[model samples]
Target chain A: MVADTASYHRIVLDSRPAGRPTADNFRLEEVAVPTLEDGEVLVRNHYLSIDPYMLGRMSTGVSYAPSQPLGEVMIGEAVGEIVQSRNKEFPVGDHVVGQLGWQEMALSDGQALRRVDIGAAPMSAHLGVLGMTGVTAWYGMTQICSPVAGSTVVVSAAAGAVGGVAVQLAKAKGCRVVGIAGGSRKCKYVMESLGADACVDYKKHADSAALGRAVGSHAPDGVDAYFDNVNGWMLDGVLPLMNRFGRIALCGMISRYGDTPMQLSAHSYLLISRLRAEGFIVWDHLDLWPQALQELTDLLQSGSLRSGESIAEGIEAAPAACIGLLSGENLGKQLVKLN
Target chain B: MVADTASYHRIVLDSRPAGRPTADNFRLEEVAVPTLEDGEVLVRNHYLSIDPYMLGRMSTGVSYAPSQPLGEVMIGEAVGEIVQSRNKEFPVGDHVVGQLGWQEMALSDGQALRRVDIGAAPMSAHLGVLGMTGVTAWYGMTQICSPVAGSTVVVSAAAGAVGGVAVQLAKAKGCRVVGIAGGSRKCKYVMESLGADACVDYKKHADSAALGRAVGSHAPDGVDAYFDNVNGWMLDGVLPLMNRFGRIALCGMISRYGDTPMQLSAHSYLLISRLRAEGFIVWDHLDLWPQALQELTDLLQSGSLRSGESIAEGIEAAPAACIGLLSGENLGKQLVKLN
Candidate 1:
């Protein structure tokens, strides 16, 4: 018999933000956990993934994914153990990762749930490096950027999750990798820890011209490939520095997730330099996930890939963690720990 | 013997313009045509191709091609008959097309010259439908856009050279084509003459939003591919209307070829819709030209392809013709008759 009286804490979207989101937009509440039906599993979420893309879902806008519905559990990915199950494939005591939302307890019907091997890495790593974040970096680097050996490749937001992995992936391909990040500390981490040949501190630059000069000095041969995470002024700075027939993999636009429309002025360079800029979401290419995961796992096991995480203590910290990530306050993959 | 004292009238770049080019930027000069060198051939020009790309060469700004130097023969393409030949490859009376410049007579060493089949089409057609204009259309359509049979395709500047051919090419591929042109007259020609399913008159729409609505009405299913010839506000209007994974062939940016940089605000749609925007110059892909020309020739012979021309008489009219073409005063391929 299931214990239907067990209580749990979950976060819900209280209201949509006008511009940048705040902690007030989310509400934490306690509710009784529902008993699982046949073929359903009750999961006790231990780690919640806080991503830059979550900001897109918070607004009622036309995006790749539908906006998060108001007054519902805030949508996100999480890694947890199956506490109770009637499903044959997933049993109690098995670790799995899924879109379990911002809650300590979740009900799953086995769809979109992947059982994780606990022996492979820590449970929280499954929500960051071994999950969607690593896969996104792999897809953009291998599929879109495809930088040739000895060529110059640049990654924006280089200290962050996807950017950190992308920087290493480019370097592994024997490319001269340059990174762009906010502040000197993140820039140092990108160069020293992520193995980027050089890193540009975007905060130090007065304008796009100054930032472009900094990037140009680091990538003197001209950028052949750019993995873009910030697409506003950051993109503006690198566009004019691209060589003929360059490629730009549009991964994310954290800077433009706000209400104000981003103004771009370097479009003329696209034609003049014969550039190709393509945008993509990792979820759209699920077929290649297995292969990407295998390669990423190999890199991790071999110690070729290194990642950093900034963890917030409980379910209550999810909103603040998300806000910190958007403002570049987090150094790496930002996550919330909930036991 | 080669004529030593034959005088020819040619146009030269007198000065670069601060913004849009005027007739005053060009100076008509009469100079004696020198005797050909050992490997050179003299050609009597028939037609001088007036293309929008010339405006880019007129300025000192970085572009695909080097800036048109001041006090030199105005750079252009022309179809002509070899009048005197020292090179056996190009005999007298042989019709050829080359970068013969804005001059009555030109000398060539046969490096970039291509022989034209004058018997198949008019000599001037080699500079329009059968040449770079048609080849450019083929490349952007077949290579970049690659619209599926039932997909919705959009072409900007649909009454002009490249756009006109691109519209017909998309039609041949069995796509539902929509054209965006400046005036109602051009819009009518785009629909009636070029066989576009619908035409949107950008002039009627006061802003990008209104223009986007007009385009949306014609393409209810959403645009799958866009052939962008005018890349400023025109691109802005069409970008948000694109469906997921839509392709944009960045052929030219006529509106932003002036001094002022074009400001774009719809870049977020690129990432949101997972779009791929690629820029190309036909000259860079010379390897595909032969195949493209062959297909174009077959289409012309089958009466499946039709093109329009706005001809200005004599080399003296090139400057005004170029100015008129840039201002959207021309109907189709703007050319100057030299003989």
Candidate 2:
């Protein structure tokens, strides 16, 4: 039988992080579980998502997304099973989705949460493949990038959660997909599993233009769409090689996530050259979420696409795994699993 | 009597310019003009427009408008009087608008030339406040920018050909206009004559964030519609200060034209901040050119819009004047006088 007394854990933002976030920026505390209201669920978070956008929220500097406020719960998404429920609409043992944040147990308002169909896929898949990152890759490619069939698609940070899914989606659209990952093994996964036409391991090439040359060899006609998950010197290479009227959907910028804000050269030439570059927040595309969910679900169940989680077990290990993500040490989708 | 034999002058693409264009990049040559054929009009140029985009065509880089074919006459708009005609549509003594380039006289197909009504304004006004530059500024504000009355409108390269007209057009639409130019004299003209609410001298402020700080002093409320001409660090300054959902109509990057191919940094922050930036080619908006001409002409006649022309005498001086434009040596509009 479950214990009557509720226990919950919260990782709070202790201070604004300087450069890459360190363990000191977060404060983990065990508190009494909040009482469920009329429309609330108690989710025992099995997995928590650790994304690059968390880097932007840690600083007050200008970013494509808003900053994370100090003294707040560190923003995140968690996949969990409901152990108790107050309202009939959400019954006990029903799997529920919510802004579970970085918590072991969450008492959430029915808002911003939905019932996850755990039967369709593993419950943890909700944190990666069929969750926000998957939806982000889906909408970013189909809406912003809008690559036509036979077009060349280039994605940076190709082995990460969103970039991995983006490669598969572009391939499904009949696009020639090129991915930029960190090393050989991830590069192999990008090509063999994600269906990327080619993969460029940035670690292997020291030249600033090496990725550009590789993309050119794979896409002789020039790239029609670029999914930017890493924005740094690498953008310099992609700008010159994009075809006229090409589209760029900016999803993340993981390369400059650490240290002093680096001096980044502008690729404004794309706008003048008829290149359409747009940045979108995944939250803004909620209207298309249902569509994104259905499509990704079909891809996963049919075995056409698969997802991998680079999981760090235990709630206390979340901070280190987050540090690992910033350092680009984690592969696939970085997750912190509560054991 | 003026020479009746075929006389020629060229707007030579002498050398690629640097920083802002200077007189050294211009070279003038005299040649024998080809004899006029059937359906052709031999016109003597009375006024030529020296515009910002001309600098773009001279550079060997990716541009929506193709770069100038080296060693050829510079492309530009001109007001010319038909001296001889072989087409029924154009006759001697008719003042027509055409792509006369930067030349003394042009042998035209009579296909591109359109006769202007002298009753509207001084025919020379057609080269300044009524020509393509005028249409470019007008349509960019009215159609693309769509600024409402009291909207904070910001135009870079403010004391320039298109910016001069844009400041007035936006002010006419009841916007509080701010201009970014180079010196005190141009800044005075932009504010005192062009009805701009404020002016920022870019030369004095080397730092873009400082320029934005200066702009903030005049317009306490953030800018709404941004008409971009000189894209570089100046744009970087305006980005952080922009209000939510502000519209940036990407016009031209005059500052980048002269530099040997280098990466330019347009603030990518706008994309994630939900600000809308659209790159527009005036040719793509040609359908609205006639409507633009009418509105600007009425404003000019009403004394609400003002124009400045640095008229260079003789066709040989045309290239030097074109170079002066990029250097910010010319106030208002740069023009060539041939008649």
Candidate 3:
């Protein structure tokens, strides 16, 4: 069930973590359903998305979104069915996606929620491939990197949500795609299932130099465009191998989001290579979202694109799932099935 | 004299250096001036420009221009009078600027040489302010960064060739310009002579954090656009204090050029801030040169632009001058007066 009634479980931010997040940072509570106001709808969240970007919001540092306040319900995105609707636009049983936080019951004014067609695709996909992750991948690939045909494009975190989509998209565009993943299983998935030309297991190489050599073996002509997801040692490994006039679309630095003072070197490569390194937030490019979504939807319908989800069974597992996602334990889009 | 006749003196690349270049890397030679071929002109180079970009050419690494081959006439730009000509375009005594190398006399095919009127500007000024430095400043400021009026723009190496012109241009565009320079004297010149709103001495700050703090005090609202001339510590110092959606036009990485891997951190800040850093070789933007030169010429003619030169007398002093220029020992455009 993607909807429920009466009192529901919700997770709230208890305290901000100093380094890597722990289960202690979140508090699970049972709260009574709220009375809906005019133009409001009550949603029972089905699947809550736990993205790498959320790690930035849980800290005191600056991010695209405002930091989550202590004791407030943790901010997140969820695709859920409307259990009760005071608004005429969203009828009961309609699936909707919104920034509804980590909760089984969410009260929305209908302005934040967008109704999704459950018949076209899986309800959970509205939280992953058919949603923000897809849009992010499309935007980064098309708008930022814009890899030319036959050029080599490299993506980090290849088996994960955005990277997976990016690798497929590059392949679809008639470009050679290379992926950097953590383990053998993910590397196999990236190479076999995702159709990447080659996959470099970053874990197989102990240090950055070894990692660089490993990545280079796959990209003999050097990287033409890069879709960077994991930014510390992975980025260092890719920098020297980057061809002149390479474009790097900075998606996420999941390796060092919450952590401050990362050890880095690449200023000379960036300048000497005449590389264009542009850091962007997907939210900033909302105007392009609808078009991106349409293209992503068409690809999905045509079987040209594929998506995977690793879902935890309940809301109680969210904190652990998020921690596991950051540690590279979860594959694809890590989510919590809250219904 | 900045021009000579009998047995012209020239400098050649002796060997590539591992770290910082020395006088041994450059060899002084006395050779007969090449005879002007058909469609060619012999230029008596009055002033030889020694720029930071040359350091990249001296090494075997990939750069904008081809690496300087060993035992060859060192590739460089110079402005001088045409002493002899077989080309109709460049008559005798016409002052022309070309990639004429580090020599007293050069044989150019007339295509490389662009005649500069000494009546409009001084001959040496063609090598500094009214030349490539001016064009570089114009391109980076106007085309790349594109700082809006009333915005705060910060420039590093503010007393040097490109940064010096960038500050004045920013001020002329109605921006509150702040400069970062090496010594107290250079800081004073950057502020008073260049009309910068504020100037910070990077030498005074022992660390990047302290330097960031010092620079931040001048730009209370944070930097809107940055013209980065020096990379490494200075870039790290500026990254944290940068405003959201800020643009950085990377002109050079002089600090890290010819140096081994440097310690750098700020990938997280870059992503969070949504900054756009683009590095360019100005030579690629030759299409915009005529328009840029015209605008710059008008600025110079109106007395809105001021230029300075630190000249090392004679071709024998060329090696020392280049060394001094790289070490930040000389202010403004460091040139060798070879006449």
Residue B210 error for model 1, in Å?
1.0
Q: Would candidate 1 be rated incorrect, acceptable, medium or high by CAPRI criteria?
A: high
Model 2 over residues B147-204: C-alpha lDDT tens digits? 9998898999888888999999999989999999988999998898788988988888
Question: In terms of TM-score, which candidate is stronger, 1 or 2?
Answer: 1
Task: Tell me the tens digit of each residue's lDDT in model 1 across B158-242.
Answer: 9998999999999999999999999989999999999999999999998888999999999999999999999988899999999
Instruction: Point out where model 2 deviates above 4 Å.
Output: A1-18, A22-29, A37-40, A60-73, A87-89, A119-121, A266-268, A294-305, B1-30, B59-71, B88-95, B111-121, B142-144, B257-268, B284-308
Interface RMSD of each: 0.8, 3.3, 1.8
What is candidate 3's CA lDDT for residue B199? 95
TM-score of chain B of each: 0.97, 0.92, 0.97
Worst 10 residues of 2 chain A by lDDT: A260-269
Give the alpha carbon lDDT tens digit for every residue of B1-339 in model 3. Answer: 434456788899999987789999999998986776799888888999999988889998766678899999998999988888999988998999999999988888888788898998898888877899999999989987899999999999999999999999999999999999999999889988889999999999998899999999999889999999998888889988889889888898877766865677765677889888888877878899899888988999998898878899988998898888888887788998875
The per-model lDDT (C-alpha) reads: 0.91, 0.80, 0.87
In angstroms, how far off is B58's CA in candidate 1? 0.9
Against the native complex, each candidate's DockQ, computed on alpha carbons, is: 0.85, 0.35, 0.66
**Which regions in candidate 3 have their CA more than 4 angstroms from the true location?**
A1-4, A257-260, B1-4, B15-18, B257-260
Q: Estimate candidate 1's RMSD in Å.
A: 2.1
True contacts kept of each: 0.93, 0.32, 0.78
Q: Could you tell me how far off, in angstroms, the CA of residue A184 lies in candidate 1 after the best superposition?
A: 1.9
